[model samples]
Target: MAHFPMNHPARPIYRVLSGLIGLYILMFGVWGVVLTAGESLFARESNWALGLRTNLAFSIASVIFGAFLIIGASRRTNLGHYMNLTAGIVFLVTSILMMSLLQTEANFLNFSMSTVIVSMIFGLVLLGTGLYDKVGPPELAEAERRSRDKQISEANTP
Candidate 1:
């Protein structure tokens, strides 16, 4: 089983990173909405917004997701942990799906190669952030840490 560090010392950094990503997404969405105001919801035509191809549908989705991420990052409880994990998976899956649909008529979000790359990067970061940002009681964290250390030592001995 995968062991996720709890009460990690670098939790603050991960939180900030997630927040920044959220801010960028929010800004990109707002700009996309402005640029694609009259365009079709799923327009296939190129409409660049904040360096990413977008449409009304994609812009709106970005706005909602960005807000969600911001809220998750602001929380001090495990809610943020779960949110980051979910967002990470969602991003990874979406990027793969969009990439596959990139050359097809089914590309509804008008995603570009750059967008896919960014999404993948964001997904990985979020996943890492989630893995280390778990919160718990002090004793539980200590116990988990000890277990992890023991596991590492055992592996090294083999």
Candidate 2:
């Protein structure tokens, strides 16, 4: 089974970084909403916010998603771990899909290349944070550490 660090020493740092990303997204969404208020839901007109194109539909979605991430990052339990993992995967998948439809009429989100790039970056960071943010009881963490040490020793012996 794959090992995800539990009770990592740097978990606080990771959480802070994730929260910062969430804040940025939230601000971007708010700005997008203000800028795109008079436009159609999925308007193709040029509306940029925080260096990314936007529309009412996309801005609203960003608001919700950003808030979700913020909540996840603020949690102290395993909920944050699972939430970050889910959000990471969603960002990655959605970015890829949007990138594919960039030139077509199907790009309802009005995702520019910059937006896809930022999403991919945020996805990777969130995924990494999730991998290291798992928390468990002391005994479980010790057992996991021992298991990791054993695996490392075995690999070194070979």
Candidate 3:
């Protein structure tokens, strides 16, 4: 028997969430790109210890991931299916890590709040898209139906 996979369209919620997540990624990427390019203005005493190299590394990573995320989300590629969930988790984890990285009296406490809010936004998008995922379950259902048909046919055969 020939085998063919079924086509599945992403749910509306997933598309919306993916786009929003893409935009969020773009925002961070732009922020990083700007900071890296214009380091002199945003430079702080604390950042001195972090060094230029570290900042550049992080900025580049942000830009790549953000741009890819936007593309993946817009394209709705297979890889994007995983990236969405992973990005959401990553943002949440990073937000927590950032909170701990800061000293209690750190001047950038507001940054923490912003991170938390952004993290929550990603979390919500992930939750919504994941819950509304349209592709995965249908395939499982199709496979199950085929299995049931095979079992029935086997039982009927003498």
Candidate 4:
């Protein structure tokens, strides 16, 4: 029997969430770049930080990240889940740091209260989606195997 990696019950949900997050990130980056006209590529104009500055560099990075998520979702690869999990953790940590250093301007990253809130939200969503289903459902897995086997048999018949 052949293996179907994306036969998990939660695969669809995970992929949808991943795609949505990717699109959001991509749009955010594109919007920022357009608004700033690339002048703030490496500038500190925006308070967002944690290698996610509101500049061109960050925008480009965000777009790439988004693209990865989208592509991973389309391909139904486990890598997408791992990447989302990592990104969630990073964003959450960054948000916490931003909140803690609200009084100081020289914090590792310069982020505002709004930025922290947004980051936290994004982090939670990513984490939730990534951790949705570590293991595939037993019934679904069996069904998937059967379906794949049937397809293979039919293909071989012709």
Candidate 5:
């Protein structure tokens, strides 16, 4: 039960988002591999124009990436924030590229418009979480200031 740095305003949000996204990706990879039986997983016809080719290799890659996100979130470090940001960018870009290559049986993420939209939304959310501290609310800064003051006073009392 590791705790994030209390002073960072968006630490909690980043941790939660990263963990959720990582879980989703890990499950998705498992689904892809199990459902397709490793065959035709990478085939374009399997889904659509989505950049994700759900073969054994891709599935393993997804799991690895998901694990990275999970570990980052658990660690609650700057590295975690950057990892989330990077994952968001990658997902968004891949989905967009898939959309651009759409065909009659082609679309992003399982040949569905909904999946594409969802991916983009998730991307934006991750990006926002990652950048939240850059212009954090005044209240958060004040709270941190007060907390530090309390710690200093407590230390002096001893």
Candidate 6:
């Protein structure tokens, strides 16, 4: 990862934004899992044991998914960005699947909302930065090409 000083061009804002988004994803994930596992409104059933098991499974899954997103976001490589995008898609898919099969649609909705909001913010950042890293900045590319063209022109002039 390129280290940028506080005064390094536009680096400060971008890094801070990325870090905040990372924190959001991690925090939301941790909270959602905890809510599911706790003796809360949604983790209710005639059979307390069953309810505990169901909520515990959900809690574990949510935490795992959230952790994956956080790790992916922390990586600065193009592969890392793609991994984060995949994690976002996983959140979307899990939300839809849970809603379709589970009776607790409301909790699922909350899960969907938080995952999507955090995932999108982080995913958008990943995509924007990945593109910038891959194709080089437009002005820089143009200048490099011009320099190369000038060299070629001089080489053939003789």
Tens-digit lDDT string for candidate 6 (7-55): 2244334444545555554454455455555555345332122122234
TM-score of each: 0.94, 0.95, 0.57, 0.64, 0.64, 0.43
TM-score of 3: 0.57
Top-TM-score structure, candidate number: 2
Question: What local lDDT does model 3 show for residue 47?
Answer: 29
The digit string of per-residue lDDT tens for model 5 on 1-115 reads 3222333655676678768877877776666666556455444445311344454545656678778777867764467667767878987996687667556444323334555
Worst 10 residues of 6 by lDDT: 45-54
Arrange candidates, best lDDT first: 2, 1, 4, 5, 3, 6
Local distance difference test scores for all models = 0.93, 0.93, 0.56, 0.68, 0.62, 0.47
**Clashing residue pairs found in predicted model 6:** none
Candidate 6 runs further than 4 Å off: 1-22, 32-54, 102-158
Stretches of candidate 5 off by over 4 Å are 1-6, 45-58, 104-111, 133-158
Residue-pair clashes per prediction, in order, are 0, 0, 0, 1, 0, 0
Whose lDDT is higher: candidate 2's or candidate 5's? 2
State the number of backbone clashes in model 6.
0
Native-to-model Cα distance after best TM-score fit, residue 98 in candidate 5, in Å:
0.9
Of the candidates numbered 2 and 6, which has the greater lDDT value?
2
Candidate 3, residues 1-158: lDDT per residue as tens digits? 53322333555557667776666556665665555565543233322111221233455565676676676566544455566667777767766765676455442322344545666677667655644443445668588568868989999999
**Candidate 5 — worst ten consecutive residues by lDDT sum?**
44-53
Q: Which residue pairs in candidate 5 have backbone atoms (N, alpha carbon, C) closer than 3 angstroms, thus clashing? A: none
User: Which ranges of candidate 4 are over 4 A from the true structure?
Assistant: 1-8, 46-53, 107-110, 133-158
Residue 107 displacement (Å), model 4: 5.8
Model 3: per-residue Cα lDDT at residue 65 = 67
What 10-residue stretch in candidate 4 is worst by lDDT?
Answer: 46-55
Deviation from truth (RMSD, Å), model 4? 9.9
